[model samples]
Target chain A: MKLKTLVLSPQSRLDEVCSEACRARINDYFEPVWNETGRDYTQEELSERMAEAEVIISSWGSPSLTDEMLQKAVKLRAIGHAAGTVKNLVPKQIFAQGVKVYSAAPRIALSVGEYCLAALLTSLRYLPEFDSAMREGKWKIAGLKGRELTGSTVGIISASSTARAFIKLLAPFQVDVLIYDPYLSEEAAARLNAKRATLEEVMSCPIISVHAPKLPATERMLTRELLALIPDGAVFINSSRGPVVDAQAFMEELQSGRFFAALDVFDKEPLAVDHPIRTLPNVLLSPHIAGASVQGHLALMEEVVEDIIRGLREEKTMYEVNEKMWEVMA
Target chain B: MKLKTLVLSPQSRLDEVCSEACRARINDYFEPVWNETGRDYTQEELSERMAEAEVIISSWGSPSLTDEMLQKAVKLRAIGHAAGTVKNLVPKQIFAQGVKVYSAAPRIALSVGEYCLAALLTSLRYLPEFDSAMREGKWKIAGLKGRELTGSTVGIISASSTARAFIKLLAPFQVDVLIYDPYLSEEAAARLNAKRATLEEVMSCPIISVHAPKLPATERMLTRELLALIPDGAVFINSSRGPVVDAQAFMEELQSGRFFAALDVFDKEPLAVDHPIRTLPNVLLSPHIAGASVQGHLALMEEVVEDIIRGLREEKTMYEVNEKMWEVMA
Candidate 1:
């Protein structure tokens, strides 16, 4: 028997992912939104389309499948996200309905971690302005006043895939690694060559990077108080979530010249024209492109497609947030 | 016979290099400038210092030993500069005095070379602003966009010592190295994993660093026309003397986003406050501290002291700019 599935978000190579689902004997693959005009199924098109879909694969900018949509799709079995976080589209309603969901957060983990390592090194060397100065043909020697990473302390503030992968990438460097994740066991931190510390200690480190999820307990992990504990000129990276640090407080501190920063994300998307962050010389700012590299997309698609194939074969989900196990595990 | 040598530069750690010189049978080290009673020296005092003084070790910023000063000492056999270039004090008059001049350019070459390499890597990574961003408690995933050094092209504009060290450092990264020194031999380039190239091709490279000496031939080696050949977003570093680059032209190009540069030296030291270079956001202007690190000072002193020792042992100078060699070797 074939298990029907619908993909909400359309990638350029939909054929590639569809073929993988086909290999696992899931014969039906449809994008309900794409099927327009003259189609006989008019009322509740999404519901009608997904009513029989055993799995739904989603990506960035995917439409949320709401309670009304879920009500009609009584046969909805699983939701698979091929991106970093499901919080963007996967609603609380999905959990309430007992719908299973999966995410390839682990696959995209290395991309963020690799970026974090580069950001870490960049911060230690004071390179951002050095490069800009070089462009202007001014031989500024202040760039030479940077600390080597050989004996510096690096604080990793999470135990998620990004944080874990960051620790793995830093193994070759001579940094004194400290990690602060309540979920991480002492044995795990030991094996990872990182000393498990409290959030207090991590923020006080010479180099601190945040990779925690946006759970209630983790939101605002780098609050104003925590930010004050951070050392001057130390590098801080946040690839986890934007709300982890308070932006207003950050701008105040940055203006005071008490520390240095490399911000790829912000509490608000597309920081307004008057944002102080855009003008600061000490900051390395972008439009949040770190985890969206070519390599990042490649890893995500590979992992998500693999899960789609395996789920069809074994009739089980991987990286599922809405899995039944969460009910008992929670 | 003891060879009395006068130290012109006040290197407190002068003993370390002198120790080696003493071991090599160099003797009678003296410096009258170290005395506060410089109003005048009695004939007895002058004879005690100059009766057997066979060598003088000098460097940049050293006071010239004029005809009047030299007349007080008749046995001065050789003039050695434990630093780069002798134009500062060794004028036509000193050469006319038939003093065999030696410079310790090679000894400090390797150290300056290391600093240049560090600058290149730091520029490539964009670390300084990132560090500031980290301190400001800003967490952004898009703070920096980095390019790996692997397979990247780096053009060396000259075969100076630091340039050679940079080529050696590039060996590990497997970068595409190019050289454009008119005086450089194909064999020398090959040994350093560099392809001998025309000035045009060298300029075409994305990473170009100037290591030419401040000689008449190399004045403004990187003119406005040469700057045009470089691709956008390429890195330019100058650890060599600043005259090789036209600051105004390069600064203009950098402002227009046509090039990027990291200059440790400038045409004018302490770059004037009103200097347009300082106002430009793209320029990394420093106080010419690239070759002025603690290591750089130590290296300079070590070489000068070594020369003093070697002068006593009748050893060949570490860096001899033979007036005769330029025709055949330069």
Candidate 2:
């Protein structure tokens, strides 16, 4: 059967990948979203344009597939997300309409995993702040103190795809790796060059990292109790979900100047102008951006293209989402 | 004979390494240049303290050892540099006084090589700026274009110790590397896993890294002609002396937004507050800090300790600078 594809966001790389995949699969593919006149279409215009769209290729900032929007896309059969999270685009009505949902979050996780490894090592080397100090032509300390990954302990807190890829990236570094996951088995951790440990054991390591998903059980997992157990000067990192950590508890540890943290996600993003974390001397803060390097976006686009191709060639869907259980399953 | 040493800086790591080595050898090691009150000392004071000092360990910002100063250190038999660049402390007096010089710049190069590699890859992934944008709480352009080091051409200019170390660091990545050095033989480049190239071939590659030393012949080697040859969106890295790159020429190329640069050095020591390069979007500005990370400093310290150990054993020194010209090379 011929497929009709519509792109909602303007990630140029995404559009190119999806368009190529669609053209290879069918001749009736179409684009319903465009920035003509430098503005997007209104609700009515969107409805008219999406009337024949069989699949939607989406990214961040895409309009939601609400009940009304679904009504207009009567023929829509699938939604392929060319980004990490699909929490915003998949409305309650999407599953009812039997529309398949796919996400490139896993592929994105791999690319981001590499980015995280780079950031982690750079943090250990104290590159950014030093670079900043040097640019100002001021040497805060005439010299620096740093450690190498060799013989160092690095703890990965979750079995998330990105975290898994991070293991592959660290293979050549020869550092000891520990993984903490209630659901993970010792054998699985070993395959990734990691030793499965309890959360307490993981946090107590010299280089503890957070990679847990955002779930009720995982939220604030690094409480004051767990954080207190970490060794002095341990490197704490989070490239996963933000709310998974307790901000106040973390701030307490940070204020002590006992540990170093490399944070890419936080409890509240764009942390407040006067947020205490911003003032910490030893912390490395980056907005919720650990997964959004240009390489990541391009890699994610490749995944979206694969999903679209599978949708056309395979009788079974590639990234079908069960609406009733998404929050729990994801 | 009793071994004598002098510490020329107040660096703790240097002190730790030197003390450990001295303890192992039961030698008399004195720290003569520490800032007791931040005032330069009289020659008589230095002479009195360093009467039997046979070796001097040096680093950045150490007092110059002019011909006049060497007369005070009459028994000085050898000088060990615990840092890169002996240009500041290596006076005609030390060489003329028949003092053999040793340097840890080779050891320090390992860390600098690792740092510049990370920075180069970071630029390829467009990281620092992406993280900066995320800090502002806005995620724009989900990802930019990213290329891997695998199979891509990487050009290295001037085969200094850092350049050689960088080549060693890149070995596992399995990338095609090209090198241009007036002093390097074709056989040497091949042994380094790099194909020797002309200046033209080096500039044409997507990534050009500089490791040229601050010699008269290398000044402004990256002229307008060379900088302009890099393809648009290619990366340019300068971890060596800043004068090697004509700053004015680089500033002009930056305006085109075609080439991205990561500079750990600059033409001027103190970059003016409004230095155009500081504000430029295409460049990563650092205050001459590539070879000065904490690890880099520690590596130098280790090298110095190794030299002291060799001296106590009556073995050949590890980093003798003027070996060909000195009778007491060991």
lDDT values for all models = 0.63, 0.69
| Model 2's interface RMSD | 4.0
**Highest DockQ model number:** 2
Q: TM-score for every candidate vs. truth?
A: 0.58, 0.73
Number of the top TM-score candidate:
2
Give per-residue lDDT, candidate 1, residue A131.
Answer: 48
C-alpha-based local distance difference test score of model 2: 0.69
Q: What would the per-residue lDDT of candidate 1 be over residues A1-330, giving only the tens digit for each residue?
A: 444566554544343223453324323333233322322233355566766766676666456666678777777766777675676555567887867667777766655665676666555555555545544545555425544453568888887777876776555344688899887899999888888999999999978888776667766767888888888767777766678787777778888876777676777875664566667766666456555444355445446655766665675655656534333221
Lowest lDDT 10-mer window, candidate 2 chain A? A32-41
Q: State residue A160's C-alpha deviation in candidate 1, in Å.
A: 5.4
List, residue by residue over B1-330, the lDDT tens digit for candidate 2. 445566555544445334455434333343344435344444455556666677766665556676666777778877777776666666645766777777777777776676677777677766566555544545444445455554468999988788887776565456789999987898988888888899989989888899887767888888989888998988888888788887788888888888898877778776666676766678776666566554455557557656755765679886767634232111
| Candidate that would win on lDDT | 2
Instruction: Compute DockQ for each candidate against the true complex.
Output: 0.09, 0.19
Off by over 4 Å in 1: A1-58, A65-83, A87-151, A159-176, A181-204, A220-258, A263-330, B1-202, B210-226, B237-256, B259-287, B291-330
Q: Model 1 residue B260 lDDT?
A: 62
